[model samples]
Target: MEWGPTGAAAVPADYAVVVDVLSFTTTLSVALERGIEVFPFRWRDARAAEHAMRHGATLAVGRFEAMSRGDARHVSLSPASLSEVEGIQRLVLPSPNGSTIAFALADSGAQVVGACLRNAGAVARWLAPRVADGASVVVVPAGERWHDDTLRPAVEDLWGAGAVLDALLDALGGEDEVTSPEARMAVAAWRAARLPDDLLRCAGGVELTDVGFVADVEIAAQHDVSEVVPVLVGESFRDATEVQPAAPKLRRVDG
Candidate 1:
């Protein structure tokens, strides 16, 4: 699951590792760190407001809209701004890539966890109990979209996924227990790349920088800085530390 919405149709795995390094997942990690619950939405449509209202959460108006308002009171998808927000209990994070993938995975009955470079190690540690129980995992690098809405493989996302996979392998004591080919490739790619500095010069990173989102890139590139793992429970993502385990070795089957 390295592109588009393919993870929705990917082979059923016990857990889903959704990575969107540009912002979504990174923002998720930050917000969850601050005790905010995130609801992944596919669109910022009228339904977003309804969903937010239902959850007593704030609907993100996006970075551009929030910037134009000249107010720091609103929460958007920006990781920096999200880190600054305080006292918010819940949020609606809508994205074409990460959120969409997460929504699909949740609908398909998978135990979904949001991951990024910032919280890769923590996420892997949180997921260790499940993985060690012989449960498989799908590492989805939710790539950016092209002009035609096709999946454009973003190097940042690949690195994010690789970081998480690598962390998982390390936790599992090596790749002997990991049989997924995609997982292995992700680990290999992350090991061969230049990391934070290289991530800044990647295509997605450059585009974000051009749009005055350099801070977001820097925030996303902070490796292993967070201990929060955003695990999707019901319709919202809450810090895994705050949530109790559903069942011991309870592996979910494909719906």
Candidate 2:
């Protein structure tokens, strides 16, 4: 899995998975757990805010730089804040990487899923069945950009992808069973697992921890904490376990 530069580019897989562990995706998961109705705004903040107010939702805004006002009362999807909320109606989120990639993949022929370190293992288990069915999966890490420079392209997502790949490999076995180049790429990326700590200390991970979302950081870093895999349908995330697990190979591993 890799994070690609944003724009209206073609999505490269039969199934596309987006990872924004630092905030956007994490916040989306947190909001859903809190019973907030999440409506993805794509890249339009003004439109998202308008929709929230129109729906009688108390708007909570989040951005790439810092936590927004009212954000403290809600679960911050980003690494900078871990505040929890009971229920949120709408979340106005803007991330340096997540939102852009998500929106791009939204209309891709591929099935899009929201992934994070928190749900890595579950995701792997879930994908097993799909792979068995001949589905191609692409894991996209939302990459970090600093002052026009994209630094550490696959650090965070690679770790998460590696965990998922390891699980899939353990379950499915052998290169012949794997068909997606993205999946193969993910396995290659995991080669860095030999120095797991250094990989975690990369740019995106450091920023996430510095922002006080260390729990999220640690949770995402850990392999396979939950057997629950979250999938994006329309605009809402649903637990994959609620449905039958895909029948590919099931490999168990710690993230």
Candidate 3:
């Protein structure tokens, strides 16, 4: 919306969909699918460890640090690392972009949901009826950061946000009234862009691949393939797709 979590908070919506397809939310999507509860953190500090300990959960390590230490068994943030892990009931994932927005929205009076290309359709389908029933929704693209720790508007996130928005707009059927210009532009970007190939060439994708985490990008690139919709429940994200009433599925716009 405006800029940071502050701008996002300014907007009044029934739901805020936070997307970080590069890693955070993608791993979240995968973890939820595997039935693991996720707690999002903004910083990788001692607080994360303490929170994890307090919850009796496992603290996630940075992807680079995990790889450096050859720690594949308990890898915290990688979708590829999920296969190597076992018995992980809860996870505290630290991400500067997506996690910060999601955690900040915990008390924003609106429901918070984690999104990526993977679960955009499911999230859209879940929101469509509520929206038709007069519930508002806002899609937040958690852009990447710059070297100086500034926000870098990552296209991968735009695509991820757009993926959710495009489907939402399609499901609502009244794009003129139910959508904003920015939402229309996001849908345009999603429609015009070659998502799968462009994601592999995008900055976020290349960054992951450059560090040997190409699998993360590949996982993030999958479009609407996942059905797990992770909603922020209290301090952590839990899958909500199970308890939701069956609604009309989004008509997938395949290219």
Best candidate according to TM-score: 1
Can you tell me which runs of candidate 3 are displaced by over 4 Å? Answer: 1-4, 242-255
Among all windows of ten consecutive residues in candidate 1, which has the lowest summed lDDT?
A: 246-255
lDDT ranking from best to worst? Answer: 1, 3, 2
Span of ten consecutive residues with least summed lDDT in model 2: 245-254
Deviation in angstroms for 254 in model 2? Answer: 35
Candidate 1 per-residue C-alpha lDDT over 59-113 given as tens digits, one digit per residue, 9 for 90 to 100: 9878888879867668798998887877788899999999999998886666888
Q: Would you list the clashing residue pairs of candidate 1?
A: none
Better of 1 and 3 by lDDT: 1
* Candidate topping lDDT: 1
**Total clashes for model 3:** 0
CA lDDT, candidate 3, residue 115: 88
Model 2, span 1-255: residue lDDT tens? 555544214435666777766556665555544445555555546776686666565444443433545445543345334335544555555454776677666666556666666566667676777777766666777766668666446566666666566666667765663445776776776665644365447776576567655565554555444444556555545565444423323232233
Superposed by TM-score, candidate 3 places the C-alpha of residue 236 at a distance from the truth, in angstroms, of 0.9
Residue 3 accuracy (lDDT) in model 2: 57
